[model samples]
Target chain A: MHELSIAQSVVEAVEKELESQPGALLRKIGLRIGELSGVDPDSLRFSWECLTRETGFEGVALVIETRAWQRRCPPCDIVFAVSDYQTVCPQCGTRETEHAGGNELDIAYLELETP
Target chain B: MTQIPMERKVLGENDRIAAALREEFHRRGIFCLNLISSPGAGKTLLLEKTLEGFAPDRRVAVLTGDIQTDNDARRLARYGFPVQQITTAGACHLDARMIERHLANWDLSTIGLLLIENVGNLVCPTSYDLGEDAKVVILSVAEGDDKPLKYPGIFHRAELLVLSKIDLLPYVPFDIAAARDNARKVNPAIEIVELSSTTGAGLDAWRAWLDRRAVH
Candidate 1:
């Protein structure tokens, strides 16, 4: 699956950060994975462990924060959480809803060793 | 002992390489396209038809990604074209690092159109970016028009949507308008072209798009 590659990318990202800060050992990686991001967190974490073995980020803990999709109804001006990609709001059935958030996959912060 | 929380994305490494790959492609004026679709969507068939059309003039190369079997690669190799097959062994999608690893020693200079045919899957492939100029998502009539609604992420991310197997549209209940409407609902700006590699229906528009990209 693409999770393997995403895992590989994560390993690479940690290693690159380690390169700059010499004698740095990765402690934790803070990742924000949205539900609509199309990434499975379980698979990603498993692949991360598999790919990070023998690397600087080996055994590093991953702190993943999940983000849910949010949408706003254009007509009602009501912001609500979208469980699925439905345009109509639960409060009011209208096709005037716009996507607000919940499709982000970002590495927010990294914990590294101190030299 | 308190472990310092070094929060960072592990994909940082691949991002750097991807940036480099993008720069390399841009410097050489190479227009790369990543073609993705479900299995039996006629991706390779479409490629064969398109390649045959531009074979004599355009310097085109294909890198087909699959879990096993070089059948697709072998089929394209007969045209005396450069084709590289990357068998992922079990991976469902193609990644940037895999492409980087195999592109060595190849004459990228002689290539005009670099087409990367990703393994057949709509879900997993959309998550990975292989530094392509555009991502073409192919959908056939047999796969149901509701595919766009079911998988909005792929449609939202793709630059072009090729509606293949149009020749079978009359036989099947594939509503072309609904498919286009759904895709537009997700992206609202995706370029769509309907064609059949088997019958050569509406291929000129497809060729024109390719030709336009090839020169620019």
Candidate 2:
């Protein structure tokens, strides 16, 4: 699954940050996954648990913030939040559509502590 | 033990590195394109055709990523162009760090067009930026026209959308109009090109777009 790759990137990123403070232990990591990012949050959480079992982040928790998908209608030129993948215009039935948001996948923050 | 709230991003490190790579590419005047699609969406075939269209005239080089097999690299080698194979082993997508490592051996100065063919995937590749000037996405008619709606992220981020295997459009059940419409639904500004590598239909338009891009 694509979650594994995202998980690895998260781990590597955390590791890089922890390198500067050699005595710090990762406590938690936070991420924001957009609805249209194509990343499964559940799978990423599972993968993170599996990879951090015996590592420096043995007990680190993962918190994910989900963002909703939004779209802009070409014919109406109106922007709206898309709850689903259907492209039908809400105000007008025009099929002309453009996704305005909900495709972001990035780590928002990470928590660490010095032992 | 107090919990310290450090606003450190988990991907912060990689993003910084990716930014550096983008700057380096800009400095060298190299335009890198990251080609992404499903495993059999005709990414390699399209690249082969693109290389044939503009090779020695433009000093083109390719870096192809696959789960396994150097077949893609081998295929491009016959053209006598600079090529590199990045076998991800089992990874589904290519990341910026991987490019940073392999890019060290490449001579970016002599290359006008640097194409980075990402691992065949419609999902994870959308999240990672490989320091490319643009992300070109391919969708084959055989894969169904609804793919753009199903995988909207890739289509939304793509600078250009190529509809491959158009020769099979007549035989297949795919509605070309619907596919184009759906892609526009995701990204209205996306440039769309319909082509068939087998019959060589619609290739001139594709090449013309590349010519315009290379000049710009």
Candidate 3:
């Protein structure tokens, strides 16, 4: 599954970040995934668990924040949340809309213990 | 116990490599296209047909991705164009790093058109950008017309939508009008092309579209 690869990337990112603090222990990772990001959170967590076993960061917690998909109508200038990948504007009933937000996949923060 | 505010994108690595690839492609005057679709969507067959239509003067190369086999590369190589296959080894999608690594020895300057056929998938590949000039998603008539609505992520990001296997329309219950409407709902600016590679029907229009996009 792609989640496994994504989990690997997450671990690699954390490892790179921890490289600066040689003896630091990773406590938690904060992630923000958008609805349109195409990442399944449950699968990611499962993959992360499978990957971290027996490693130094085995018990590290993963906190995920999901963002809703939003779109903005150019004519009406109304921003609204969208579900089921609907792109039409609710306010103006027009298809001339642009993505406003919720396509982000970011590592917002990390908790670590310094040695 | 202390929280560090990294504020970094998780896919930053892939994005960085994609940006560099985009720059390199533009510098070489190469029009690169990324084709994405589900398994058994006839992506390889369509590519073979497209390659046949290219003029001998036009320089074209293809890079295909698969989970474990080099079969696609072998198939396209018969066209006599430079072909490279990236065996993802079970990775569902192709990242920019993979493309960069595969093209390490390629002479991009001589290629007028570069086609990257992504691993046959409808979901994960939509999230990764491979630094292509345009992304095309293929949907065959046999797969039903609800695919556009069912898998909107790929359709939303694609510049063009190609409906393949039109020759099977008489054998299947597919509503072309409904499919077009659904795709338009997801992406208002998307261009649609319907073709049956088996009969060479609509192949000329497809070639014309490629000819317009391929950089000389």
Candidate 4:
């Protein structure tokens, strides 16, 4: 529902990052959105379109690299990705797993316009 | 193609604002809680009960958010506590700016415990931080037992899970054990308090949890 706001933030952040190169154009925006980020990539893409409809970012691409929920088994000394929010270790079947990662919501890179 | 590696958070602006709010809250010794849940999960009723339990002179305030209604604010005001309504118009979630704006004119020094009832949403509200000391997720027996698994983002991030509307557990097909197990699966350390706003059962335990922060 607030995807538009998120998309706007993305644009604003990119523009702020490119303040030194205002004349430089962007080709694509790479995003790393984890499964637990609570952001649907499709909805964000649609919102991106709505935001950049007639702007300089109109034709720029949004490449999203999605991630899975990852948990670390303490005794087993192993980190693994698990689906369905089940943190049970695949190797040890222990429930004492720590969250290793999967809440990523970062702008990975910006592909600038070709000369 | 000039590929610049820009590893930055998309919601950096909101996060910065939230961090500032957190610093201010910490400076003033204010403990704030952000409540997330799906619509009709009895967030308002639980808040109503909580306010009713507090003393009339308690230095507690509330900020309730809804997409369109001042009705919740009106309901929460009867307890004589300072309550502010954030009508987001059409936004599904409340950002830190909204909270900051609502708290702009208010006297923060007098507020020790601040409760923010977020707009009823299991998904969108999970990403936005409100500078609260903790995030409490509410799950009612009337909803699905698999909500913790389905909406793991919110469940995974929250510190406590309030299982509301438990009085109807017998009539509903929802499984309490499964619900608790699911919440634990995602968040092994999540504290849960089962209660019904109607029967007032387990309100003491809920109040006790609140007391740890307020009455400590």
Considering every candidate listed, which one attains the maximal DockQ?
Answer: 4
Clash-forming residue pairs, model 2: A97-B185
Model 4 global lDDT (CA atoms, 0 to 1): 0.93
Q: In candidate 2, how many Å is residue A113 off?
A: 7.1
In terms of TM-score, how similar is model 1 to the real structure? Answer: 0.81
lDDT of 4 by residue, B1-216 (tens): 799999999999999999999999988989999999999999999999999998878899999999997999999999999999999999999999999999997999989999999999999999999999999999999999999999999999998999999999989999999999999988998999999999999999999998885543
- For candidate 1, lDDT tens digit of each residue in B25-96? 888888899999999999999988877876476678899999999999998887777899999999898878
The prediction achieving the highest TM-score against the true structure is 4
DockQ, candidate no. 3: 0.70
Best by lDDT: 4
After superposing candidate 1, which stretches have Cα over 4 Å from the reference?
Answer: A15-28, A45-61, A68-103, A110-115, B1-9
Question: What's the residue-level lDDT of B183 in candidate 1?
Answer: 85
TM-score between candidate 2 chain A and the true chain A: 0.76
Candidate 3 at B201: error in angstroms?
1.5
- Tens digits of per-residue lDDT for model 2, A5-102: 67877887667666777777767777877887888989999988888788767778998989888877887888888755555689997767766778
lDDT of each: 0.81, 0.83, 0.88, 0.93
Model 3 residue runs over 4 Å out of place are: none
Compose the digit string of candidate 4's lDDT tens values, residues A72-100: 99899999998766688999798889998
How high is the lDDT of residue A41 in model 3?
Answer: 90
> Model 2, range B41-68, lDDT digits (tens) per residue?
8988888887787647668889999999
Better of 3 and 4 by DockQ: 4
The count of residue-pair clashes in candidate 1 stands at 16
